[model samples]
Target chain A: MQWLTIYKKECLESARNYKWVWVPLVFILFCIMDPLTTYYLPQILESTGGLPDGATFDIPTPPAANVFMMSISQINTLGVLVIALITMGTIAGERKSGVAELILVKPVSYTAYVTAKWAAHVTLVLLSIFVGLIASWYYVQLLFGDVSFIHALSTAGFYGLYIIFVISISLFMNTWTKTPGLVLFLTISIIMILNLVTSVFSHLLEWSPTNITSYLPSLLRTGEVGQDLWLASLFTIVTIVLLLFGAIQTLKRKEIV
Target chain B: MIQLKNLTKTFDKQYAVKNITFNLPSGKCVALLGPNGAGKTTTLKMIAGLMHPTSGQVELANGVKGDIRKYIGYLPQHPQFHSWMTGMEFLHYVARLSHIPKHESQKLAEQLLDRVGIADAKNRKISKYSGGMKQRLGIAQAMIHKPSVLLLDEPVSALDPIGRRDVLNLMEELKQETTLLYSTHILGDAEEASDEILLMHKGAIVESGSLQDVKERHQVDKITLRFDGNMKAYKEKMEEFPFVTHTDIQKQKIHVYVQNVPEARDVLLELVSKEQWPLLFFEVGQTTLEDLFMKVVNEHAMADHL
Candidate 1:
């Protein structure tokens, strides 16, 4: 019961943060970007005094889902950045700012305090993803016409988990240092490193949730859960669990000095 | 009630607090008094459950120790709040942390803001509140749930005279229900507000008990003497006077606190005649709190110097 009070307070605070607003706005903008680029590039080239040669072939019809598909990369970039930025302060900011001393004076332990904080970040990321999905739905319906609800929901769900995974990684990152910026950087840098490694070294990167960002959406594309299923499942579950456990343990032993 | 038995806390292989033993009976206010860096805050933190003692244990006299935590409200020295929150919001958060229901948390939050004298700025962020206002809010947050034990660490530091008066009054007001123990560097504030004073020095409570008792035990013989001319000759003459332990001369005045003040009176008069030190005033009295503090601090320094 008491935990719910803290959770509610945290949720309200997340709502007030501007990053929550920026997440959906940026992602929605990114989602519409590919379609706009596809629609205009041919015209732009033709206007440039016709291809400069007699042999100019027509551009292939890109898939109507290209705009929505671009959301994958968007999620890995802006989504991960937003996740880290929002959750960087999950524990370290409070500890560094000395607010932990104020809050811990009550019956609230460091465990409950940090758990509620991460819960807030998760809720924010989830809400932002939901907002982005609504905007995507509007744009896809207007531009592509009739996106499968299953595709949209599954894609949104996968991205939601990815965002949570990013935020959780940040919460774990907090234990290493007490700076919110540094912790957030570590979260983004780790995700980016894994992403780069998987793209360049397929055999080396197949061990973890390397393809979850790219492959999770493939589940939506095919309406089946085959894209990096084993790796994504293992990585998402293990990363979240390990990170949350690490966050809880680090916070539990945190000294307010 | 709160009892700490052999409570000692060590940090980085050094004892930050050692052999702390005391009991705070319910409904009484005890002051943990000390100078800067005296481990007063450490002892308070240990009692507040913010830090664990390396040795021994703290026992609540009435309820189970764990249960007692539910009834404890702590105010840190530089009380920190969520900077983005209003005084009302901060109080509400604390209310909820204290397990008040959502409805009651909001309701009590308003009432507490009023009680702490910040109801006017209930919607403004805490970062914008004045220091005195912030300190009051800190106190308000601590007492919001009406905890049974209120441990305030330098609760009145940032308060002005009127604010200090109000906070002290609030503490007195809370005495009917809560066991209050606070630490402060402000000796006068402690003297004015506390029934008992725990004088901490070198990570240990060197002196404690009723304020009057501590003062009485450490009282020095005091003499205020006024002379017409410079007190230089008189000061030098009184240094050799029988029973005169020490003397400090300031202009035409001589301030002396001696071991045998009664015996020094006649010698003082004789010195006035011999040295032609024109006397304007001569008086004797008991030591004040400031005198006791200086004596205790200097004695410790002298002992360590040896």
Candidate 2:
């Protein structure tokens, strides 16, 4: 119940700061622009003076489902950056400004305080992804061919988990440092390192969470799930839980000075 | 009532508050008197459970088991709030965190706003609030849970005179409801507002007692005489009087410590009239808290010097 109250305050703060509006706008813009440009690539290229006058090149227009999946893939990098940027300051800024001390000085439990922040960030990330995915579904169907609504929903759900994973890292880093900028830099750097390792050693790192980001688009195009998808997701879910738990313990041990 | 047992906090191999113990009885306003860096804030934070002591414990009188925080309402020296929030919203949020019912929180927040005299600005954003208004709002939020012990750290040290008077009066009324322990360096405010005093120096308590008791313990019979003439010469002449046990010159005033204040006063006045000394003022009373504070702090400094 105490967690719920804190969650509401967090949401209200986000709403007032225009985070709820602009973050989804960034997603919707990326999703809309991806499909619209892909559909008109041939004409857009020809108009730019086709390959040194008289040389012509063919550009393939993929299926609507593929275009929608491509947009999700683009969101893979930019979306993670957005999530890290917003979540970097949630805990660190409060602690720096002494607001955390005031709140924790009350009867509020450490678990309630940290978990509420985690839930709020997860809620906002999930909502923005849902809205952006729906908008992209409309644009892809209009410009290219047919893609099922259920396909988009499942893609959003899978990718939303990956985004929540990013948010969890930001929250964990926030507890470790007082500088929000450092939280942002460290979170992005860690994710980038994981992504690079997953690509370079795919078989060895099959059960890694970063593998899920690379596999989600293919899963949407074909009705096939990667062999390690379940294992990777299990790891991601467990990691998210562990990270939140680590955050709570860190906050408990590092009471305000 | 709250009992602090051997409370000690050390940072980076240095003691911020060291091996201090005191009990705060219920329904009394005790002032923790100390200069800056005397560890008053650290001691209060330890009691508020905002900081864990390197050693020792703070226990409530009832011996209640879990989470001593619910029973303590602490206002830091500089209170920081969510500046984007309205006063009403902040208080309501605090009340909800304390597990007050949603419907009741609104009413309680409003009532507290009126109690703290910030009701008029309840709807305004806290970013626009003046320092004193924020201090009052901080006090209101701390009391939202109706905690048994209210620990305020330098509540009025940052306020102007009017704001200080307002907070002092509010504290006077509040002591009737809960045990109030606040820290301050302003001796005059403490003298006017508190029932007891705890004088801390160099991270340890140097003195602790009720206002009357501490004063009586260090009581003296003295006459203070000020003149336009040379203060050292007057001090020398005054010391020769038989009733005048000793004398010291301070700020052009002669403090004549005597065995008998009445006999000393009569003799000093007669000598002044006969010699036509330029006596600017004459005061007969016990030593003020300012005198005691300087004496005690200087004594500690001299001890540390050795």
Candidate 3:
């Protein structure tokens, strides 16, 4: 119940800051541009080329599933950056500004405080991603052809798990650092390193959470779910839970002075 | 009532509050008086459950030992609020955190805002509030839970004269309804507002008692006299008197500490009459808390040097 109150406050704060509105706007904008750019590339090449007398250009219309995959890739980079920017100050800012002392001095539990922040961030991430994916699907249908709604939704669900994983890592980093800049730097670095290491050593690290990002595009393109995808999804969910638990412990022992 | 038994807090292997023990009787306002770095804030934070004591315990009136924060209201020396939140919103948030019923929390927040005299500005964001207004809002939130004991750390030390008076007046009114304990370096404010004084120096309670009792214990027989004639000659002559133990002369006034006021008064009057020295004013009384606080703090400094 107390968590609910705190969660509402977080949501209200995001609304007041216009993060809830603008973040999804950015996402939807990126999603729409992906399909529109793919559709117009041949015309753009011809207009800008001024090709020599015998030069020839051949461009093919890509599949709608491929357009959806292209949109996911765009979201994988920009969406993660947006999520990091939004949540970097969730915990550390409160501690730095002395607001934590006031709230913690009450009868409320530390678990509730951390969980409320996690839930709020998850809500925003999921909402923005859902809207962006649906918009991307609509644009793909209009510009290219029809893509299966179930496949797109399933891909988004799997992909949303990876975004939640990033958000939890952000919450954990915030608990460990007092500076929001440091939290952003550390969270991005950790995710990038994890993704790079798992991709390089894919034979050994197939079940890593980073695999979820790779599997997202393939799942949307191929319309097939592999055993590796199932394992990676399970690993991503477990990692998020563990990160939240770690965040709670770190915050419980945090010194507000 | 609140009891602190051997409550101590250590920072970096050094004692901030060391084996301190005291009792605050129910419905009485107590002032924790000390100089800066005297561990007054540390002690209050410990009781407020904001900091854990190194080796002791704070037991409430019912003898409940742990997690008594719900029953105590605390205001830090410099309170911080979410600048984006309006005063009413912040209070409602705090009241809800204390688990007040949803319907009652709104009414309680309004009552508290009015009580703190900030109801008119309750709709304005806290960032727009002045320092004094923020302090008043701090007080209102601290009292929102209606806790049994209110712990304020240097509540009025940072305010201007008018702001200080407003907070002090609010505290005076609050002590009538709850057990209020506040720490301050201002001896005059403590004397004016508190029923009891706990004088702390170097992480220890050097003196603790009711205002009257502490004064009586440290009181000395002293008389202050101001003259209209040559002050130097009068000071020298008065210093020569046998009953006069010590004399501090400044300009036209001389403060004479005596062994017995009656004997010193008779002798001084006779000397003044015989010499026909012009006199303007005279007063005799015990030492004020200001004097006592300075005496205690200075003695501690001297003892440290020794």
Candidate 4:
């Protein structure tokens, strides 16, 4: 009941601050732009640039699945930035402003406090991802070709797992530090470094959470679930749980001034 | 009832709150009196379960120990609320966190708003409220759960005079319903509101007792005499008397600390009449709480140097 109460407050906070509206809108913008730009590149280039007299450009439209992958790449960069901006102040701001001191003095447990924040963030992340993916799916069908609903769902679901992992890491970092700017920097840098390492050494880190992003486009195209995909999903889920646990412990030991 | 047994907190190898022990009786108002950085906030934080003690423990009624935050309500030195939330909504959120049922939390929030005299501004965002209104709201939120023990840290320190009066009056009313422990550096506020006082210095309690008892124990009998002209000879003659234990002279006035006020009064009156001393004013008085506080603190400082 305590966690539910805190979770509801978090939900109301996000809604009132228009985070629910703006975050999803940003995601949808990225989603729509990803495919539209890919489809209209030649026309855009011709309108913007004066070509030489005999220059003729030929550009082919990519496959529907490839457009979805382009959207994933857009989210991998801009979407993560948006998420970081949205959640950078979740715990650290509360602590700095002394709100955390008031709430922590109540009868609530540390686990409930951390979990409630995680749940609220997960809700926002999932809603934003779902809205963006559905919009991307609709445009991919119109601009490219007919894309299977099941494949699109699988792609979104796989990508959603990676987003959740990033959010969990952010929350963990927030609990560990008092500076919101530092937390945001550390979380983004850590995730970026991990993704780079896993991608550069994919042969050695096949089961890393970053592999979820790499497998998402393939899963959308072929509609096949691989053993490594399953292993990566498991690893992501375990890492999320472990990060949340670590956050709770860190908060428990934190000296709230 | 709550008992702090040798509670200590250290930060970066420095003791914020040293090993301190005290018991708070139920339904009584106790004031934690100390200067700034004297560990009052640290002690309250440890009791509120916001910070774990480096050593020792806080034992509640029935000897139940470990996270007794449920039985305690705490307001920090500067209580911060979600500025975007209406006063009523914030109280409702606090009630829920206090484990009140959802259906009843709304009613409790409304009742507490009225109780703390913030009902008129209950619908206003906290950002729009004045300093006093916000403090009243803080008290409303802290009382929403009806905890047995209430702890407030410098609740009136940041307020204007009117705000301080309003909070102190509200505290007076609340002290009757629950055990209250408030920390403050203002001796007048503590003297006006608390029945018992725990005077802390350098992270340790230098004095603790009922207000009347502590005042009585440290009270010194004294007399003051002011002259219209220079009274150097008169002051020297008065200092030779056996009854006058100490004398402080400022300009033409002499403040004489005495062993027996009646005996000193008689001796001083006879001397002033015989020598035709220029006695412009005279009065006898006992030491006030302020004087006792200064004396105790000065003695401790001197002893520390030794």
lDDT of candidate 4 over A1-257, digit per residue (tens): 89998899999999999989988998999888989988888778879875778987667678888998888889889999788777778998899899998888888888999899989999998899889989999999998998899989988988899999989989998898878998889989998899899989999998999888888777887899888999999999999999999999988888776
Give per-residue CA lDDT, model 3, range A1-257, as digits (tens). Answer: 78999999999998888988898898898788889988988777679965677977667898898898888888878878888888999989988888877888888888899999899989988998899989999999899998889889999998888889999999999999889999999999998999899989998887899888777767776679988999989988898899999999987776655
- State the displacement of the C-alpha of residue B216, model 4, in Å, after optimal TM-score superposition: 0.9
Off by over 4 Å in 1: A18-20, A44-59, A65-67, A109-111, A137-147, A196-201, A204-207, B10-15, B54-56, B66-68, B226-237, B247-254, B278-281
* CAPRI class assigned to model 1: medium
Model 2: lDDT equals 0.89
The prediction achieving the highest DockQ against the true structure is 4
Q: What is the CAPRI rating of model 2's predicted complex?
A: medium
Tens digit of per-residue lDDT, candidate 4, span B81-194: 999999989998989998899889999898888888889999999999987888888888778888899999999998999889989998999988999999999999999999
Reference contacts recovered by each candidate, as fractions? 0.70, 0.82, 0.56, 0.89
What lDDT score goes with residue B105 in model 1?
88
Compose the digit string of candidate 2's lDDT tens values, residues A1-257. 89999999999999989989998898888778789889888778779865776665667778777788878877887888888999999989998899887898989988888889989988988888888889999988888888877767776787788888889999999999988999999999999999898899998998888888777777777656677787888899999999999998998888675
Q: Give the Å error, residue A158, model 3.
A: 0.8
> Relative to the unseen true structure, what is the C-alpha lDDT of residue B279 in candidate 1, on a scale of 0 to 100?
78
List TM-scores of chain B, every candidate.
0.89, 0.90, 0.86, 0.89
Whole-model lDDT, model 3: 0.88
| lDDT tens digits, residue span B160-206, model 2 | 99999899999999998999999999999899889999999989999
List TM-score (chain A only) for every prediction: 0.85, 0.94, 0.95, 0.97
Write down the TM-score of model 3's second chain.
0.86
